[model samples]
Target: MPPAPASRHRTGRRTHGLLAAAEGLATAAALTAALPADAHDGGGHGHRPGRYQDVQLLSFNDLHGNLESPSGSSGRITELQPDGTTRTVDAGGAEYLATHLRQARAGHPYSVTAAGGDMVGASPLLSGLFHDEPTIEALGKLKLDVTTVGNHEFDEGARELARLQNGGCHPTDGCYTGKRFKGAGFPYLAANVQDEKTGKPILKPYWVWKKKDVRIGFIGVTLEGTPDIVSADGVKGVAFKDEVETINKYAKVLQRQGVRSIVALIHEGGFPASGAYNYDCDSPGAGAGISGPIVDIAKNVTPAVDALVTGHTHAAYVCTVPDPAGRPRMVTSAASFGRLYTDTTLTYDRRTGDIARTAVRSANHVVTRDVPKAADMTDLISRWNALAAPIGNRPIGYISADIDNTGDESPMGDLIADAQLAHGKELDPRTSLALMNPGGVRSGLTYRAKGAEGDGVVTYAEGFTVQPFANTVNLQDFTGAQLVQVLKEQVSGANAAAPKILQPSAGLTYTLDLTRSGADRVVTDSVRLDGHPVDPAATYRVATNSFLAGGGDGFPTLAQGTNDLVGEDDLAALGTYLTAHSSATSPLAPPAADRITVVQ
Candidate 1:
C-alpha cells in the first residue's frame, strides 16, 4: 500500500537545532542535579475528564538493551513510499531514536511512553556487561509508563529479570547488585506469565494510571510460546499461559476496579505486506499477518479493551479488526527494535460506556535521525554510558573485516554458524553441519582500526553482549531426507516460488531457482558429505542451538533428530573460537550453499 499523506507540522529549522542542543545541555545539568521530571502530558493547554478523552499513549518495542551509541546491524529494510518504490532504510542504535521519541512527544497531554518487550537482553557492550542495568536506568529516566515481557527477558532466568525490573536479588558483590536503576514510575505487567507451583501470574497483571480524572489501564503479556522459544535452562520453572484467557480474565478485573478503558500491551504481532507477501503493500488483508493465538485474542478480548498494542514478530501494521460485539476494535503494532511506533488516539464517548470506535485514529511514527532528543532521556542515556565506560569500552580482541548483515547472506550470521559447527564438533564429532536462525544474530561485529586507541577494546563483555542469550548448543541426528525438508521450509512463503532459502553458512552449499515456487523450488536432489554425494537414507548429526533443536523458526525436522549433545553456552563458544583464531583476520567464510538446490 502507498504511504498516506504526511501530517501537517512546521518548525523553524535552525531554531529547532539550537533548541535541541540547549535541551541536551540542560538535561546533562538535570542529571548532575539528580532531580527527575514530574510526569506531565503535553496537552493542548487544558485538562480533560474520562478515559482517553485527551490521552496519548506513546510506545516502542524491541529496544534490545542499547543504552548508548553503538554499531548497528544490516538488512534491506523497506520504507513505505507515498508514490514511488518502497525505499530501503538501515536499522540500529538507540540515541538517534531517543532523540526522535522526545521530539514526537512535544506538546501532547497525558502522553504515556512504554515498550512491548525485548528491552534489556542480547545487548551491546555499553549496557549488557552490567546485566542491562544501564538500559533500565535509561528507561526510568525516559519515564516509561509500562512494558510487557519479551522472551529475551529470560536470558538470565526469572531471578535476573526480576532484579532488572525490581532490584537486584544478589548481594552488592554480585554482578547486577550495585547498579543504579530508576525503578519504573509504572509497573512492568506480565499478566500471562505464571508460577507453576501456585498457578498464579508472576508479575502484576495491569497498571492503572490516572491523569486527573482520566483513568487509563495498561495490561502487559508475553507470548505464550516464550518458554519454548527460550533456552531450556533459562526458563525451567515458569509457565506462559493462554493469551486470550489471561487478557479476558484481567480486563474484567481491571473493569471491576473502576477502570473503563483498557489496552493490551502484548509481545506478539502479525505479518503485514503492501503488495505481495513479503514485498510491498498492495493488498488489504496484509495487516492480518499477526495471526495464530493473537488473532483469537484480538477478536475475542473483552469489550473494555479500547486498543491492542502488540510486538514480537517485528512486523509493521495498523488496522481495526472486529471484536465479538461487531464493534470496531483497533489493533496496532510498531515494527520491532525502535524502528517504528504506532500512534493511535482513542476518544471516550460520554453517553455510551465505551470508547468511540469511529473517533479512533492511528498512525505509525518512524524513528528517524531527523528528530531531536528529549533532554531528560538523552541525559539518562549519557549517565548510564558513563557508568558503563570502564567495563564495556575495554578491548578484548580485533577483527580486520567488516562483519556485515546487509544482505540475506550475512557475514555475521556465517561467523555465528561457524562457531556453532566448531563447538558442536568438539562436544560430539558426529556433528557435520550447523544451522542458525537469521533472527538470532541480534547485532554485528565491527573491528577497530589497527592502531587506534585503548588496551581493553571490545571486551569479552562486548562479544557476549552481541550474543547475550546463553542459548545452548545441541547436536541432533537427522537423515539426509529430513535435512532436505528443512531447506524447503525457508521458501514456504510467496517467495517460496522465488527459490530464496535466505542464507545459510559455509560447510554447506545449495542452489535456488527464482522461477519455481515452494518445496518444488528446492529441486537439486544431490546431498554432499565433504564434497561427495550422500545417501538420502544416511543419518548425519546436525548441530544447532537449543532453540532450533526444539523446533524454533519453523524448523521441525530438528526435533526428530536423535542424540542430543547439549552445551551450556553459545556465546562462550564463539568467544573462545574468536580468541583462538584471532589472526587479525575475519574468521567468517562465504557459504557453500549445499543443503538447498533449485532449478528454473
Candidate 2:
C-alpha cells in the first residue's frame, strides 16, 4: 500500500531554551524549598483545608494490544485474600479495562490516565492483524493522557512508530475502517531515545498536565539497554541514553519551567517479592520487598522527580524507594496484559506547586470481569473482530490438551522448538536441533474452544497469538563448542541478572543446576544430542528464529553461526507441524516439558 496523504505532525511540545538563567536559578531555589520532606518519616504537617488537591493518577502498562480477553494464564491475576491465601482472578480485555478506568475516575474531577509503555506489539489477532490500529483507537477512547515508549514500540522500527503517533492509514494494509487513522490522541514520550546524528529526542521528552495550577510534569523513558533486546533494524539511527541521566536532565528542564511536581514514567521495572497484585511491597519498609534495575534507577534519579510509574518486568508492586536525599518516594508498576492497574493519589500542594511526598499513596487493582463491559469498547471490539474473523477463525490444527507457556521449560516452548526444527529440515536436511527464546513464545494453546471452534481444534488466530512476532525460522551451522557457549550465554553475560532460557528440540537435552551460578549453571558434561555426547570439535546445524540469529535476548553466540538460510515464518512452520502431526480424531498432546534435567 502507498503512504497516506495526511502529513505527519511536528514533534511534541517544546519549550524555549533561552529563558533567563537568573529566573531559572531562582525557580530552582524555590523548588528546593517547596519539595516534600522525608516521606518515610511522615514529617509533613497535617493537611490544611483547601490547601492541597488530591490528584488521581491511574496507570497501567504492557497492554500488548489485547482488545479481547486474553486466554490461559495471561488473563489471570493473583489476589491475596483475607484468608491469608492467594487466588487467581480472571481479568483483562479492553471492554473491562475501559469500564474499570471510567469507574475509577468517577467523583475525581482532576484525574489523569497514563501508561508505562508497550501499549501494543505481540498482540492477539484482533489487534495485530490490522497493525494494532484497533488498540491505538481503543486507547484514545480509554482517555489515556500520556505514555512512554517501550522496546516493543520499535518492533516494526521508528518510522512505523511515528506513523502510529501521527495519523495515517498503514502504507501497505491501508485503512481498515474506510477512514484515515487519526493516530494516538495522547503523546508518546521518549526522553532517553534520541536521534543519533542530531542528538535530539525522537518524541516528546516530557509532557505536562495542568488543570488550573495543579500541574504535573511527566518524563518517559524505556530501559537504557533497549538496543540489546530489540532487533537492530527496529532501533536503527537511535541511541538509548542512561535512564537516570535522561530523567534527571529533563527534571531540570521541567523545574526551569516552574513545574515542580514531576513523575518519571519508565518502561523498566523491578520484581516484587510477592506475585499477588495486592501485595504490599512497602510493608517491610521502603523498597524492601522489591529488587531489580528499577531500584537502582529510582535511588539514583534526582530528588526533583516526585514519583516513578514503571513497567516491562510486568510484576505488580506499590513500593517506595528513597530519593538522592534519602527521602522516600513512590515507585509503582501494574502487571501486564491489562490485567491490573495502579491507582495513585498524589497530594498536590497548590501553594508550593509540588506533591507532598509524605501524603503519596498507591495500590494496584485488578481489571475484574465482574463489571459490565463498556458499550463503546464492545462496539469497537466487535467492529475489529468482524474484520479479523475471515483470517482468524480458520482452523489451523488440533490439540489433545492445554500446552502452556510457563516455567523454565514450557510445553508450548518445546512445541515451538520442534516445529522450527521440522521447518529447518526442509531448508537444510543437516539441521540437527532447534532453540527458541522464551520471550518469543507469547501464549499457549488450549484444547477448549474459545469461540465456535470445537474442542481440540486450534484456529489461525490462536496460533497467531502464540507466535506473533513474524520471525523466520532460520538455519545456521555451528561448532559443538560454540553451541555449548550459546547455552552458557543464557545464564551469563548480559542475561546474568535475569536468565533467558532457550527451549530446545526433542533430540537435545542438558542439566540446569540452580545451585550453581552464571555459566556454571549449565551442566556441560550432561549436554547431549540424540543420546550422543556433543563433541567440541564436531559441527552441527542449528535452527532458531531470526531474532535469535541477530543475537536478541542476550544470546550473542547464536549470532555468530555461519551458513544462514532463512525458512518460513515461525507461525507458519507451527501450523504446518500441527497439520502434519495431528487431526480431529488423533489430536496432539502437550509435551511433558521434561527435556531439561533441572537440579536445585
In candidate 1, stretches whose alpha carbon ends up further than 4 angstroms from where it belongs are 1-52, 73-77, 89-93, 169-182, 274-296, 350-353, 372-402, 406-409, 425-430, 446-462, 474-505, 511-524, 537-539, 549-568, 576-600
Candidates' TM-scores?
0.78, 0.92
Per-residue lDDT of 1-600 in model 2, one digit per residue for the tens? 111000000011000011112111101001122433422222236633365777899999989889888888888888776576888878898998998898889878889999999898878888888888899999999999999999888877888899999989888778788999999999999999999999999999999999866899999999888887777778899999999999999999999999999999999988777777777676657788888889999999999999999998878878888899999888888888998888788888877899988777777778888788999999999998998898999998989999998888899999999999999988888999999988878889987899998998999999988888777888999999999999999788987877778889998999999899989999999999998899999999999988889887778898899998989788889999999999999899999998899887
Best by lDDT: 2
In the predicted model 2, the residue pairs found to clash are 1-172
RMSD in order of candidates: 9.7, 9.4
Candidate 1 lDDT, 1-600, residue by residue in tens = 111101000000000042232121101000011111322223344653332354677777777665544454422235544354555554334666666666667766657776788776666655665666667767776668789887777776777677767764333436443544444455778899887888787788898867655677888998786764566566768899878888889989988887877888988765454411123221244234334345667788877798888776655556566677876666766665565565566664433444555566665655554555556667666666666566545455556556654344467667778778888878887778887766566666655432233322345545654565556778888888888887776566422322223335455766656476566555545445566555578888887777777765555666788877788577777776776666344443333333444444
Q: What is the lDDT of candidate 2?
A: 0.84
Model 1 TM: 0.78
